[model samples]
Target: MKSGGNLEAVLNAGEFAITGELGPPRGTSIEAVREKAAHLKGMVDAVNITDNQTAVVRMASWATSLIVIEEGLEPNYQMVCRDRNRLAMQADILGASALGIRNILCLSGDHQQFGDHPRSKGVFDIDSIQLVNMVKNMRDEGKFLGGDDIDGPPKLFIGAAANPFGEPFEWRVHRLAKKLAAGADFVQTQCIYNMKKFRQWIDEANDMGLTEKIHILAGVTPFKSIGMARYMKNNVPGMDVPEDMIKRLKGAGKGKVATEGIKIACEQIEEFKEMKGVAGVHLMAIEWEHRVPQIVEQAKMLPRPVITPGSGEA
Candidate 1:
């Protein structure tokens, strides 16, 4: 019953969990956040509030997470190591817990150079794996990183990011194992466009028995247009968009690419449902929140299952 959150309960109950992402607005637009969350309210088990994603500044993740909760959705609060020291990290964890944020995704955020602020100094005091261990200790030991006692430790279901498409392919599984050892209860991988490679990676995890130790939620994103597909294929690091997929998008003809993209995403979700090591799908409909329900329904993941607390059954 880790964290007693819907995500953990769904995974524990052996349901194919669905999670969505919500990027905070660049300014103080609470309405904007709520509007985006409204699109995903009942379509996903939990929503991940990205923390200064791509190193661009925005509303703080913890605050946005609270807003999502106010909208009647559980938040998977994301924390990146690029902007905060350990002290700030632990403080934010405590604050998020106090605010009822039960799920968190730990990450080594995109480097600052890639963002609007190229000159900003990064404070990568600790890597993502270390951050995972820190959170686990706080939850299980009720102690701070400095070994100090806490009046109340955060009971969070910790998560970390995985890049199964990263090069030196053999090391990907080992990296996941390291995160599991560091106490990541679950992981959401980089966007998976290369299903062949993803299947191989999951098979490796299954062979190592890593799947049983950690919940691996395969990441999926629909290509909104041909430009998006080409950009991800050539520009995005660790993204593997097969050429045939791009051709397929082109084959869809003008004015219909977006629809084709959604169809492809639905097909991917169907495949994920049958994948052995996959516990769920993390639908990262970047800025396309309004389309989430359509995709989920088309994938036949509609009417999400309900898991009663402490029962571990959907």
Candidate 2:
């Protein structure tokens, strides 16, 4: 298994780190995920396997991450505290480590009512911060909640999500600080559509010294149409696609709106590409994975110095 610290090493070796999210299928068939994995192979540093994303029933993240690993790609295994208690959460972390899934994204999942299954009860036995602490303990102390030593403690490159655009922005920053203090090695932010606000947040993070503490990957998603833009703005918590973007979508209309969105996303990426404290962009294309390579290429962020596996040492 690759060392869990490799992710931090890679991020530190360069000014930018690129990662993409892959939503696992809800069914038993592995064919769909396998196809997606094949397309993403060698194109990104890591592919995040979403865990019951949006509270919808889907393929468990651990299984999907294992599939990505078997496909010869780095898998960012997402672990959400909404569905599992401390026991299950710790067990799954160990299980993921055994499967060679080194990178983990800790999250407090979306409420069940927001998902397709409204009647399903939510199990937020552990919040996001506590989950981070759990993983930190498992990594540092090599013991579970009961203080019993396992065969071996899991080594995980822990990633936590942040929403700079969410409500009570002060609370957002405070929580991010808490997560980092709890041992999050890196942070992947929510979709950022407003460059001005994004810059402001980056400034704040830099002032708080997070810029030096952990790799911060700014999230960007391409809007397919005006409908999508509206839906995301209205529905997705911690996301806000501005009116100008929606106007752009309306002006571009059906055929080329996605291309327009791509341009916008690329522009956002380019704007942050050379910034001193910004680490890199985390592209979340949802089902539009095929467009990522083009976005990267068009942004002229390509031809980055390749740090082949073992070259990330300090």
Candidate 3:
């Protein structure tokens, strides 16, 4: 369910939500960024601009979020603490809200050393949980990090990340609980490839009485190639793919693997849509944005209502 104030309107109306990820350009030109935003404008509820995803250098998330707003698409802007201190982090949060971007996803970004930029220094001034608490304090208390009151406080829907398949599976539930305690309104999990693991994670969350506090969106990404799968497994922290899925993809012929990936993503989403704690599916189609609508439709998750003035409140 879209639990963010503005996003909730969409969920309350029975909208099967859609969100896209944009790796903002490292260079100045936003032509490519705008083009991607334009392509998903009416098709998605919002576009998430990843902040230095994979620890790779790229355009700043705040600027790209503003660009997405300018392109007429809502932005679920990503804020990672690996690159900024609490001071910068707080400023960006206020800045984004002032720019009219309502959704903020708190993340402890991947280390720069893990990404292509090994030479870049890593900054973990505050982990994702602290960032969540910071934003909540800012919005709820009407004060900045320094305890100074503002004329107009920022408003936003706070989100945090969860990885069920990460090492020590039980930690996922624990971390999620911590995030909720820190005032996370919603959670977008790491890309899920194994359903059993996801269910186990959800059950643990439910047992802790967390299922009701925050909206959980199952994250799914369609693999474009076997090589990419390997990259994800080897490089991405808090991500683990099963042997069976890799075997299946490996056995599939080159031309057929991507189709299998899409099919698997669709199946996973279909199942995730039915789970008890799940709010909805956040399809990270990545470069395959064009396939999202079809994937949702083929999975029988379409026919969403309009999220507008007349929709009743949840």
- Per residue, candidate 2 scores C-alpha lDDT tens digits across 1-314 of 22444455568676477888899998987888888888777667788999999889899999998888878778899988778888899889899898788899999988888788988878889899888888888888887877888788898888899999988876777777889999888899999987778787788888898778878898988887778889888977778788888898778766998889898888888888877567888889889877777877887766544566666756
Report the candidate with higher lDDT, 2 versus 3: 2
What candidate 1 gets wrong by more than 4 Å, as runs, is none
Minimum summed lDDT over a 10-residue window in model 1 is located at 305-314
Flag regions of model 2 displaced more than 4 Å.
303-306
Best by lDDT: 1
Which pairs clash inside model 2? none
TM-score of 3: 0.92
RMSD of 2: 1.9
Best candidate according to TM-score: 1
* TM-score of every model versus the real structure: 0.99, 0.94, 0.92
Q: Spell out the clash pairs found in candidate 3.
A: 1-279
**CA lDDT, candidate 2, residue 171:** 71
Task: For candidate 3, give the lDDT of residue 291.
Answer: 73
Could you tell me how far off, in angstroms, the CA of residue 295 lies in candidate 2 after the best superposition?
Answer: 1.8
Models ranked on lDDT: 1, 2, 3
Please, what are the lDDT tens digits per residue for candidate 1 over residues 1-314?
Answer: 76989999999999999999999999999999999999998999999999999888999999999999999999999999999999999999999999899999999999999998999999999999999999999999999999999899899999999999899999999999999999999999999999999999999999999999899999999999999999999999888999999999999998999999999999999999999999999999999999999999999998998887788943
Error of 3 at 74 (Å): 0.9
Q: What is the C-alpha local distance difference test score of candidate 2?
A: 0.82
How does candidate 2 fare on TM-score? Answer: 0.94
Query: Count of backbone clashes for each model?
Result: 0, 0, 1
